[model samples]
Target: MIAIIDYGAGNLFSVKNALTYLGLPYQITNDLEEIRRADSYILPGVGAFPFAMKMLRQTNLIEEIKKQVVEKPLLGICLGMQMLFEESYEFERCSGLSLIPGKVDRWDAGGLKIPHMGWNQLSVKQPENPLLKGLQEGDSVYFVHSYMAYPKPEHLAAFCEYGVQVPALVSKGNVYGAQFHPEKSGEVGLQILRNFGGLTK
Candidate 1:
């Protein structure tokens, strides 16, 4: 079973619904035991960084999450992806899960529209990545965010150009992140989730 973390963030329903539609078994919970017992875990979020981290702390799931991602396949979406980094400059100051070596900051483009919301193509940097196996370059994915992660080039799995080359997909060992909401990206997105679901150990 796949565990969809519920830390009081938005987009849980869509993630769950997508899994259901795909005929994939899953559970939505904040319980650490449930998280650890699951075959795989998905961290889905859409909201402020600091507040989301606060919720995780309130539920006492931070360490549990770190444990799971370090030893198992864990997928993070959007803000959930941002939370995997070491720190974020979203609001005043906030620390993340530090699962990956990077920092989250708002887009630095001078006049480009903030919260790059729309369909953008992904440029596969590491073609052999299981998450990007069947996906190709120029495949459009939906994105809706102001802040983006800045992991080193070696950690980036795929990227998308929007004024600048943004880290759209990143993975290190068993941990993976997608800046775009695959649940909202139609067929391509569903395929990505299906691919992730198939990565269970």
Candidate 2:
């Protein structure tokens, strides 16, 4: 079973619905034991970085999640993905899970718009990355965010250009991150989730 961690700040139901549509077994919970028992994990969130991190700390799932990801795959979506970085500048200088080497900060956006929302085509960086297995040449995904991660090129699996190049997908070892909401990205999104499901095997 895959654990859909509910730390009280996630877009939990949509992610759950997507997983259900894919027929993937999952459970949404904040219980530590259940998290430890799952084969993989999905950390879905939709909120400010500081607030979300505070919630995770309050629920005491930080250390356990850190431990679990060392042995099992973990996918962080949107705000959840931001939390995987070393720190964020959303509301204040806050520490993140530091699973991936990067920092979250507001992108310049080149004076286009504040939050670059809507569909964007993913420019694959590392085609051989397993999470991007079946993705096509021009596969696009939905994005809705203001802040973005500035990660090392090696960790970036795919990216999309807005006013700036946003990190769309990132992977390091068993951990993966999607800056866009794959659950809402249509067929391309489902294919991404399906690829993620294939990671456990």
RMSD value for candidate 1: 1.0
Q: Which consecutive 10 residues in model 1 have the weakest lDDT in total?
A: 63-72
lDDT of 1: 0.90
The TM-score leader among the candidates is: 2
> What are the lDDT scores of the predictions, listed in order?
0.90, 0.91
C-alpha-based local distance difference test score of model 2? 0.91
| Candidate 1 residue spans exceeding 4 A from truth | none
Clash list (residue pairs), candidate 1: none
TM-score of each: 0.97, 0.98
Model 2 worst lDDT run, 10 consecutive residues: 192-201
The candidate scoring highest on lDDT is: 2
